[model samples]
Target: MADLTTTLCGIRMANPLVLASGVLGTTRAILTRAARAGAGAVTMKSISLEPRDGHPNPTILTFEAGVINAVGYSNPGVEEALAEFADLGDVPSPVIASVVGRNAEEFARVAERMARLPVAAIELPLSCPHTPGYGTLAGQSTPEATREITRAVRAVTAKPIFVKVSPNAQALGEIAAAAEQAGASAITAVNSMGPGMVINIEARRPVLAFKMGGVTGAALRPVALRCVYDIYRTVRIPVIGTGGVATGRHAIEMLMAGATAVGVGSAVAGGGVEVFARIAAEMAEWMDRNGVARVEELIGAAHR
Candidate 1:
């Protein structure tokens, strides 16, 4: 049999499949359920210093290619998150906390508080495309912003930090490299693409209440793969390839693109948490059939 176990910044996982943030990671129960369902690791939804109501209804819309969402950064805030995830003794897989803020100070403060918990790592989503006063809309996608935010968080937590970047940034590789240089332990390449829009045609307005949202699903895979590939070549840190991964073959393609682990988000909406087990099994089967004894061997195979 082929080994699916892998490690990210010293945190070991039974498989390379991770439950991406903001999918079904709304509560501790869901996070635990994802682990029990076969996710090797799980990330909580992005939390801010204060609770947010998020956008109005119709925040999410599904199209033929993928789902576009302007759900905003809705969360119970860090205090509630701390209480919810306080005890991880029962949770089987490692938990990664995803933090977001309006600025470097807020990011650092949130990271400081979240790091006090037992999470295995800290992830900063500095690339959310649809949110105002945060992410790309706030010009946080620049390499300078990446480095500053990463450095701020680094000062507060000794825990490993993973900088989540955007696909829309032209200097995506440079942004990844900046994060690495500023003390990030890993890179989560490519947050959902576009604050894209869909129109009802009949209503003639827009589909989402917010009128725009970040894009995810099959439409994002190729762009995400390319982002991961570029980041890998630019930095020595591990890259968590996120966006549109749905099947074992897609996972394999991400691994070859230089992802230390693959992130699964929108696929869960269609396949449920069981998707993790199915993808892992498929990965193992493919590995065995190809005579690859270890999952690590597949990482960056394309570059080789």
Candidate 2:
């Protein structure tokens, strides 16, 4: 077997495959199941300071291309999350808590609460396109504000922090650098793009209840790869590459683009959690064919 183990911001992973911040990240059982299935690490769904109902139904729409969603950061507030966090130590794989907030104080408060848990790290989704006041408004609105939020979180936690940014933001490189300067240990690039919509031709109206939602799937790969590659050059910390990874080949591309770990999301809606094992196996096969002895050796190979 190939040595598939990798590290992100000092947290060791059995393999580079991470169950992205959404998907089956809600409860302890589902998260542990994903780990047993093959995920090296699991990121809990983005949580907030208070419980949110999220947007109405039809928040997600499926099409031939991929998935468009405006789930609106639905999560059971930090206080309620304590129950789930209690089971963290028993999980087979390391758990990373993903958090979102309306302002710097809220972001800090959430991180402070999560810091009490045994989480490997805290990820800030600073750039979610569909969410109005939380991610998009705080991140893309200004790099300085994003920096401040990160700084606030940094002030409260000794655990590693990862900042996940959106592609819709301007000066992505600068925004990433700002987070790093504010004490982020790593960066996850390119959250879904566009609050795009599909119209019901007969109904002559939008399909999704939210009207527009972030686009995720095969269409986002190239754009996300570029974002990771650019951020890799801008910051010294590791980058967690996520966008439309559906195969081991996609994972390899992210590593070459300087991602320390690759995130698996939308693919789950198709291949199920087994997609993690499939991708890992595919990656090993590719390595064998290329005579690559270690997975880490492939990181940033494209740049060299």
Model 1 scores what on Cα lDDT? Answer: 0.94
Clashing residue pairs, backbone N/CA/C < 3 A, model 2: none
lDDT of prediction 2: 0.88
> For candidate 1, lDDT tens digit of each residue in 9-84?
9999999999999988888888999999999999999999999999998988788988899999999999999999
Would you list the C-alpha lDDT of every candidate in the order shown?
A: 0.94, 0.88
Worst 10 residues of 2 by lDDT: 134-143
Can you write out model 2's per-residue Cα lDDT over 206-274, one digit (the tens) per residue? 988888998988888899999999988999999999989999999999999999999999999899989
Q: How many clashing pairs in candidate 1?
A: 0
Query: For this target, which candidate reaches the highest lDDT against the unseen true structure?
Result: 1
lDDT of 2 at 267: 93
